[model samples]
Target: SAAELLGDPAAYESMSQAANPYGDGRASHRIAEVLLHHFRGKPRPADWGGHA
Candidate 1:
């Protein structure tokens, strides 16, 4: 759709993709670990940091 909007079929080739700057898409998991329990009554993993 971006390429179509730009009217340049080659535009897609120039697009750049990168990792999510905020986190590794585990925000919901992190929130659940804090506000809710994942496995009903287990402790969170030792390394539960958001991202690198």
Candidate 2:
């Protein structure tokens, strides 16, 4: 299935620049922030740790 999907040249290019359904490539940063908020028991600002 993976090979079939990637084998289509047009499909490959289309998928490359597709908008991320999640929070872009900054998902890890967002996840870390949520963890920190839960552990610290407070609403931390977006800039709490650093830039995403």
Candidate 3:
């Protein structure tokens, strides 16, 4: 499978450039803010400035 995929330039490029479904690995930051707000009454930080 790996060799087949690598051999096809178009397929490899398509897969390499595809958008990631998960939002830029900032999920932990949001989760931390939520937990802090819930447990310590701290204000949640401003929205993470990231592309949708």
Candidate 4:
């Protein structure tokens, strides 16, 4: 089934490289904001996972 998804080279490449169903790993602040504002009903924290 997984190999079948690779049959179309272009589609496979795009799918393989595209964003996953989960949130993007690169946007910690954005993800944190979403989690806080939407899910937790809390304010967006100042750090948002970028701590020293």
Model 3 stretches astray by more than 4 angstroms: 1-18, 46-52
Task: Compute the lDDT of residue 34 as modeled in candidate 3.
Answer: 85
Off by over 4 Å in 2: 27-52
The TM-score leader among the candidates is: 3
The candidate that wins on lDDT is 3
Q: What shift in Å separates residue 28 of candidate 3 from its native position after superposition?
A: 0.7
lDDT of 3 by residue, 1-52 (tens): 7896779998888877777877667788789998999899999777776753
lDDT of 4 by residue, 1-52 (tens): 5776767787778777876666556577676687887787887555544422
lDDT of 1 by residue, 1-52 (tens): 7647478646644543444566667767667776545657667545664453
Model 3 — which ten-residue stretch has the worst lDDT?
A: 43-52
lDDT of 1: 0.60
Q: Which is better, 3 or 4, measured by lDDT? A: 3
Task: Kindly provide the TM-score of model 2 when superposed on the true structure, using C-alpha atoms.
Answer: 0.38
What are the root-mean-square deviations of the candidates from the true structure over C-alphas?
4.8, 6.2, 3.9, 8.6
Q: Candidate 2 lDDT, tens digit per residue, 6-51?
A: 7888877887767765535676777788888889876874754333
